[model samples]
Target: MAIHASPRVTEILAQKYVEPLRESGEFAHEIVESLRAYVDNQMNIPAAARSIPVHVNTLRYRLRRFEELTGCYLEDTSTVIEVSWVLEVFGRDL
Candidate 1:
């Protein structure tokens, strides 16, 4: 028999993965905004930093902190998947 992934299971996993970040404080909010902007802009770090009005180093630092808090690197495959889900689900709110 072949195991198949279900939509309900995927939805649940997506929600579980996104809940913490959604509930986090201002830092997470900023990080999410920054990340979304970066992803939306095709992963352009300098452009994102400029758009967010922060220095590149500051943006990088915040991104590092975000990775630490979320225990997921923004560049990682799984994290990218989760981030994409979050962006799709809540992009308008951010």
Candidate 2:
């Protein structure tokens, strides 16, 4: 089952998350990268930091900003699961 980046998927994601990232500024990629790694690591902050090749403090800052921008909470299990899926679907499509 191979998936490709489709315009429809991208467009939907754009409305849900991408648009916010775009407004987050030039370093938005860092936030996305960190978030992907965070979810990949089962939402473990320290592991996410190591995976992102950044210090824990940096990742914390990005996560804070992510919550601020999205009104999503990393500490919440449901939010974490939702975000993980969003990242998975969004990445698979891309």
The prediction achieving the highest TM-score against the true structure is 2
**What would the per-residue lDDT of candidate 1 be over residues 1-94, giving only the tens digit for each residue?**
1113355644664565555566666666787777776777667789889987888887888777767766778787777666766567666453
**For model 2, how big is the CA root-mean-square deviation?**
3.8
At residue 15, candidate 1 shows an lDDT of 62
**Weakest ten-residue segment in model 1 by summed lDDT:** 1-10
Write one digit per residue (lDDT tens) for candidate 2, span 45-69.
Answer: 8998998699999999998988888
- TM-score of each candidate structure, all chains considered together: 0.69, 0.74
